[model samples]
Target: MSPVLRAPLGRVMRWHRPLMLMVASMLLLVVVSVAGLAFDDRVLLGAPVWLKPFKFAVSMAVYGTTLAWMLSLPHRGRRWTSGLATVFAVAGFVDTAIVAIQAARGTFSHFNKSTASAERVMQVIFGNGVLCIMLANLALAIILAVQRVHADRAMSRAIHTGLGLAVLGMALGFLIPAQGTAQTALTTGGERVLLSSGHSVGVPDGGPGLPLTQWSTTGGDLRIPHFVGLHGLQFMLIAALLLAALAARHPLLRDDRLRARLIGVAATSYTGLIALLIWQALRAQPLIRPDALTLAAAALLAALTTLAAVAVLKAGRVSDGNPPAAQQANLDGGRVG
Candidate 1:
């Protein structure tokens, strides 16, 4: 059987991954969203006319697929989880609908408290939709935490850590909206222009950025870590799964407990790195800047990650052939940026 199936659900053995509806809907949105690119229409911010629709479409795909995968790790057959999954799927559609409609209307999707009744109504719809999606995620986290799903011990622990970190990342996102609604300014050809809510503290929003990511090469951008932390669960869990898979072929990772320990270390260090990124952004340091302090902090995080790898190697010393369990695989092939 498949490697994962080999480690069937222990106490919660009957569970399955209910990803069909969510996946199909997200794929449909993605397909429909592409047509927006062909239109010659309004630009809300500095991005293309279709940018919001495209971005939201992609976001829904990633969210649906990633959450589907994570949720699969827990109990599957229960009626409530299935219902919740369906509700979350609908929430994704609602999210995409609001963003797309706003884009088509040639207005901003966020931070634009327009006084017109129609505009206000649309904004309210968008805001309420976002809140619902966020709460759904929170509810998912709580369920996964309280209910245990049987898997390899190391894999299980890794999943828990990754999921928890993903939640933390989502929480950090609140900082963006909570900040003042001041528009960022950029200077070009001796003229000052305004940019979207990329939230630059030390430099302008529109600067030399890394292509599509638009993370400032010349300023501080909290979105970087916020993005990174948001994907924490997927990244860490992927590592655990890879290591678990490798154990079948490599003697070094045979002790699942050691793998679990390594995942824990990785998770702790990962959260630290996320915090460091946020701290750097708050300091208004450019993402691509080579300032000594930023370099040092980045170096430290790298070192810790490397050390964790070494620990994973030595972790096999116990050789109990078992331990705890883990999360994150390219997350059903989700993409960021």
Candidate 2:
């Protein structure tokens, strides 16, 4: 056999490589976001644009790597993981293809100039695709939660808690009224009164006429707060998986350590991002900006967090370098038995 074919495929299949790829993918996303914010006009030029295809390619790669890693886990919930992985993988591929097609056709650049009917059809197709991905992600979270509850009660509780908080925040957002006027209106005896005007009703301007809400309803504009809040599960799950990868390097309590880290990171990052998004939503400010201060802070945070996680993982591995005599004896006995 060729040396390449004889090489260890199992080593290549290890979680570490996929984790590293995921990190790289996220960094790419951060860079793209920063570039888009910093050089909007230059980076977003017309059809067959260089950057657009590259960005979509990177996204597809990230999603594919993540799905592969998750499905490779040796867990009782393999069925669920495989199913969700397939869904996400398919969604990612479809999304990339759609974007590529649009880019080829100059739809993104000439969206405003496109015929109304063509625009409507494209909108429905893309909207449905996004909806499918969101539903698959949500379902994956629920399945994982159920599996954790049966396999590890404590981890299950943490997952459930995060899920509950996310749901609660979304519900509360809906109940709170928007700033300006009633979200809905009723006409009686030739008189009109507003019925709803809050985040809960999805009418932030107190009336349905607001451009933001109208565009959002048509899937033209995305509400940052709502989008962030709704996808809280994804963030938390990713955070948890990252910590788990870190913990797996250790020998003793490796699994437990990974689980703890995942839960902690998930909860912290999720809460922090949600709070920030909500604040921006309330103040009518963009969640992301090209401000030097914001960029610097984000870069610093990412660096510090990565360093801390690496340090903890290294320490755990060092601590678990040797097993106690009792554990060795038990292992020998089991092997003999």
Query: Which candidate number maximizes lDDT?
Result: 1
> Candidate 2: worst 10 consecutive residues by lDDT?
212-221
Tens digit per residue, CA lDDT, model 1, 1-337: 6768667433223332344555666677666666766654444335554665676677666766766665555475456666666666776677677777666666556655545687678667766776666666666666666655547766677667767777677677667665424573322122233323445667544456666566777777877777788788778768888888889998767766677778888888888888898888888787777579888988988897888778667556644444333223353345442
lDDT of 2 by residue, 1-337 (tens): 7777657555445644433454455456546544543554332211123344455556456545544544454456666656665665565455555555554443341122234576567656654665565566666556655555424432454555455444534443333433423433222122233332333222242222232222123111134455456545455556555544655674434556545654654465555555554544454433433245445655655665566656656666765765678998999999999
TM-score of 2: 0.46
TM-score of each model, paired residue for residue: 0.77, 0.46
What RMSD does model 2 have?
12.2
lDDT of 1 at 220: 78
Q: What global local distance difference test value does model 2 have?
A: 0.48
* C-alpha positional error of residue 156 in candidate 2 after TM-score superposition, expressed in Å: 9.5
In order, candidate lDDTs are 0.66, 0.48
How many angstroms is residue 44 displaced in model 1 relative to the true structure, after the best TM-score fit? 3.1
TM-score of 1: 0.77
How many collisions per candidate?
17, 9
Cα-based lDDT at residue 307, candidate 1: 83
